[model samples]
Target: MQLFAIGINYRTAPVALRERVVFPLEQIKSALQALNATWGSNGLSNPHAGLPAETAILSTCHRTEIYGAALTGNASSMQASMDAGYAQCAARWLSACRQIPFSELTPHLYTLPHSSAVRHVFRVASGLDSMVLGETQILGQLKAAARAALDAGALGAYLNRLFQHSFSAAKAVRGQTQIGAHSVSIASAAVRLAQRIFERLSSQRVLLIGAGSMIEVCAAHFAAQRPHALVIANRTIERSLKLAERTNGRAIALASLPARLHEFDIVVSCTASVLPIIGLGAVERALRARKRRPVLMVDLAMPRDIEAEVAQLQDVFLYTLDDLGAVVQKAHTQRQTAAIQAEAIIETRVERFMRWLDARRGAPAICKLHEEAHRLRSAALARAQQRLACGEDPKAVLEAFSYRLTHTLLHAPTRALTQAQDEERARLVQLFGISA
Candidate 1:
């Protein structure tokens, strides 16, 4: 099997297209299973019956990526075929699964095969490929993806090893380099943008929507400002309450947002909801209720917790992930040196992983070689046993066994050397490490 990756990310596609391919966290396992089923029969029976022997899907706000190993019997011989055939199949599968036009999606997709796939995953896990350089969240997201794939039975030996090494590479980069120095994550960027819109976060009423990791991070950042009041609203009251308790804030039902939207001066939302939770009409109502008081709204969700049209409001300031990208980019130059070091570390790990993968590909040949040796040894033992049974001298029987085993082991190589051309003979000699 050959490893490969196909996807579209912030650099290759906009949110409009990226959002279209998002496999929601709750849907990831099912989506992975579906992907496997699309390629081949699922379950324990005949796992390698399809093109995709292993697979994992990583869908975050900025990217939707699929990492997989194609079931090519002879991986080295089918490189060109696997590159085009597997990529096209994956692209079509994604298009069909997401109900997207193949033409529209293919233009933005990037298909990486073999070592390139390994290198790309390593860079991503190390945060060198993040919109915010050296950000650590993508590593967690990748771990979650691997876990999901494993649960779905879509993860195989190849991907399992790849992800583990990817994690190790990430840990090494973060520990050995200064890539995380002065890190500006999306959560912090949202806070920074809110600070710019409002004179002081301490005096503002902050409302956080959703109870996921992003919101939790945002809450921590905004909480550090000692906002006048912090409230977390979510569809799940228990989850919201837990997050609120951690941040020393209050929790409210998501349904209450429509009724109390005007209560907060700053609203930050990041949810998995497919549709906008806060619509333009809701914002308009909130604005009127507040008598056009300015509200700073930051949306960290992909489908967007806040509507795009809300940006048109005269007294409302709205920012999406794309808007926060610029704020995060400002810190990119500061970490360039660390990023360079991280890249070197990732390259080294990538080569190491490829070597392991190559060794793995030779496993069947190694198994066969061991089996042949065992057969020869057994056959030689049988002849020695027969001589012993015929009342031959024990020492003589042992000597005959040793001589036959040695001759048998050397017979193949001796015959090959005799039949080989001069160049081939030299190669065979070197292979056996035979002296002149």
Candidate 2:
């Protein structure tokens, strides 16, 4: 069997492309089932006809990756396929699933096999791959992905173990290293950017667009500043109410944003919407109403909740994900020493996981050996019981039982050793731990 990870990340593709492939939380389970069906069969149950019997997908704002294990197949064929490019089949599946052209998506794809896949996941789980270095949010996002795959029945032994190991590795990285020290989350960074424009957040009105985790975090950060007012707008009023209750803010319908746009001094938006929600026209009207008063806008969405044209408005300071990336990059450099230490920890865990994987490959042989030993022992025990029932002396019966068990256990090794050539004889000697 071969383990692999195939996908694209923020490091590989820009937000424009990454957003195209994102699997929303509600769709992840169905996506996994579809992927499993395309791979043909379960490799664990029918090794010859399947690829990636076990599969899990990690889809976050920064990346969408498929981690899987392909069971018994033609070694040469699989190797040749890997050499040609290991990600083609999976990438094709993703393109079809996400409705993107393979040609357009292939350039940004990365395919890592076996150990590389293991190491890549370990690093990802440990926050080594996050845009904001050492951010803890991705770890939770990955766990949610694993849980979704499990619910879909797509996760098998290999993937289950891999995710468990990755989680433990992440815990170790967090507990043993200083990678998280003084770390800046994207939400806090947005707040920091807003602080740059407004002398004090206490005097500014803040509006959060969307009720997702990013927006929730931003709400908490802004609330701490005791903003003049905090409002949460969401497609669902229930969701907006829930978030607003927690942040001690007011809930508003997302449809009312344009009418209320000029009311807030700062706006932060992150949503699953495919198209931009805030347009230039709305902002222009809002600006005119506010007498051209400056407003800070941060678009944390992948495809961006704010229109690109909105950034061109003179009275508005709009920041997209790429802008936040640049801001976080400066914080990432300060933790280089801790990150180096964390990488070392991840490497050790990767080696340990690979060793466990290698042992799993020999499981069939080990099971067969166990079955054979059990058969011989049972046969010997039965004969001893028969002899005793036939009225043999107790002492003699016991001695005979020991003799029979010992001879039966050593018979095959003895015969093989006696008839073996020099090399085979030496191997037998070592295998059976012979005296001479």
Candidate 3:
């Protein structure tokens, strides 16, 4: 069995590059199905072909990663060559999925195999690898990814075990350590960006593009500032109105965004749209409407509710997940001790998880060996009992049984040794611990 992972994260690539690789939630299941086709739908590995039988993809604003396991019909039988080949295949799949050139993706990509891959996932789920250390959002993100792969029938035993272990490890990390004890940076990140763009957040008109939990969190933070005007917009006016009532802001339909886009000085969007909702053309028209007055835009969606091209507009300052991560990373210094404890917990869990994985790898061979031994023992015992029952001498029957059992046990090894070549003979002798 071989375990492999290939990915690029915020630490390795900037937001500009990250957005190009983001997988929309609606398309994740289909993407996984397409990638797993190389291996076959029945979840069996073809040793001659290096494609992975079990595969999953996790894509967030900060990272896009692929995790895979390839198990041969022969239990736990995988080679270094096979692992390396599959790693490259996974990378190519990611590149193709996002329509990015391999040459461009290679420099930023990180590929991990076996224990390293398992450890990487453990760290990610625990938030140790996140831009904001101990932020719990990553765990939710991972669960979402796992669900998508499972729904698509692209995930199986090896990956299933890996993710379940990850979840348990994360729980242990969070429960035993003070990793998430501190205040979260998520609520303040947008406000910080807004402040940077304008001299005073109080003077800016704020428009929040979604009424989900994320928008609620941001609304509270922005409400504390009491901006000049606060507006909530959603596909449904009722939901927006509820959120707007709390923030003492008014509600607007999402469709009204295009007409009134230029009215707001700050726009924060975190909708669940699969495609870009705020296009470059829309922002451009807004900029023209405002006579090129600067507007701060924070796009918190995974697939990006705001268009990437919007960042290029002269008067629009756009920030993505990676940008927000920078704002949160600074707060990590105060929680260094808690993070240290969490890392230690993760390390212990990672070792335990790897042991479980190793045991799984060895199971097929172990079962076969046990079964073969049991069959030989049963046959020998039956023959011995029959001879004794026929009134043959008891001692003779026992002796004969012992002789036959010994021969059966030694048969395979003796035959192998007899057929061995000069070099093979030396290795076989050492393997069986046979004296010279």
**Which predicted model would earn the best TM-score?**
1
Best by lDDT: 1
Candidate RMSDs in Å, in order, are 2.6, 3.1, 5.0
What are the lDDT figures for the candidates, one per model?
Answer: 0.89, 0.87, 0.84
lDDT of 3 by residue, 28-53 (tens): 98888777764453323555544476
For candidate 2, write residues 202-221 as lDDT tens digits: 99999999998899889999
Which is the better candidate, 2 or 3, if ranked by lDDT?
A: 2
> How does model 3 fare in lDDT?
0.84
Candidate 2: lDDT of 279? Answer: 92
Candidate 3 residue runs with Cα over 4 Å from true position: 39-45, 48-51, 72-84, 196-203, 238-242, 245-248, 279-294, 307-316, 388-436
Q: Which stretches of candidate 1 lie over 4 Å from their true place?
A: 41-50, 73-77, 419-427
TM-score per candidate: 0.93, 0.88, 0.81
TM-score (C-alpha) between model 1 and the true structure: 0.93
lDDT of 2: 0.87
